[model samples]
Target: MKRVTGIGGIFIKARDTDALREWYSRHLGLDIADWGGVAFRWNDDNPGAVGTTVWSLFKADSAYFAPSDAPFMVNYRVADLHALLAALRDEGCNVIDRTDESEYGKFGWVVDPEGNKIELWQPPEGQ
Candidate 1:
């Protein structure tokens, strides 16, 4: 099984999220939405296969990356969340116990050796 197919998103914690968002929007020409993020869409070489990469900024004190103490978190796309998570556990990786499911897809997390939280996402079929 593929461990990580691709990067799903990059999230950063900033002392001033609003300021950072404005900076990215003005300097990088990112169409940041009210939610303080942007989704970049691209077409794969394969016909009709479109993919997206999300970029977002969060408040410095946000608990989203909790227990990791890292200012940033990386979300990786996976083909099978449950299977990959099981493999990670079998490999002795520190897989977080919590899981979430929603209209978006299934979600899970694991902390790297350096204590950076990693997000794993399996997008809903045909997404």
Candidate 2:
């Protein structure tokens, strides 16, 4: 029997679709069509990474983040935390870099144009 593999896509609601699409394209370099959502490119050479590239977003006010008061839309695993943070800032994106050495990994946060919180993570060596 076949089995499920990985994630498919992330669908986000936006107050202003045009503005949101433009913002992602401008800031994150994500090519979004007039009505199409964002599509992230992954390394083709990596066999371990074969699936739809996306991260879903749920209501933070709900039981998503547990007892935390802050809202967490999604957490993304990025390659270069510093470089990505810098690029996001340079493109006028709201980025919060709170890099702390922990057992988990280095982490940071960014908010999209639609005010959804996005978490960027850099995994530790030999994880």
Question: Each prediction's Cα lDDT score?
Answer: 0.90, 0.56
Question: Candidate 1: which stretches are off by over 4 Å?
Answer: none
TM-score of each: 0.95, 0.45
User: Which residue pairs overlap in candidate 1's backbone?
Assistant: none
Report the error of model 2 at residue 85, Å.
Answer: 0.3
Query: Using lDDT as the measure, which candidate wins?
Result: 1
lDDT of 2 by residue, 67-106 (tens): 2344434566666677778888888987764555577666
Candidate 2: which stretches are off by over 4 Å?
Answer: 1-72
Residues 52-80, model 1: lDDT tens digits: 78999988999999888999999998889
Could you tell me how far off, in angstroms, the CA of residue 47 lies in candidate 2 after the best superposition?
A: 7.9
For each of the candidates, the C-alpha root-mean-square deviation to the true structure, in angstroms, is: 1.1, 13.0
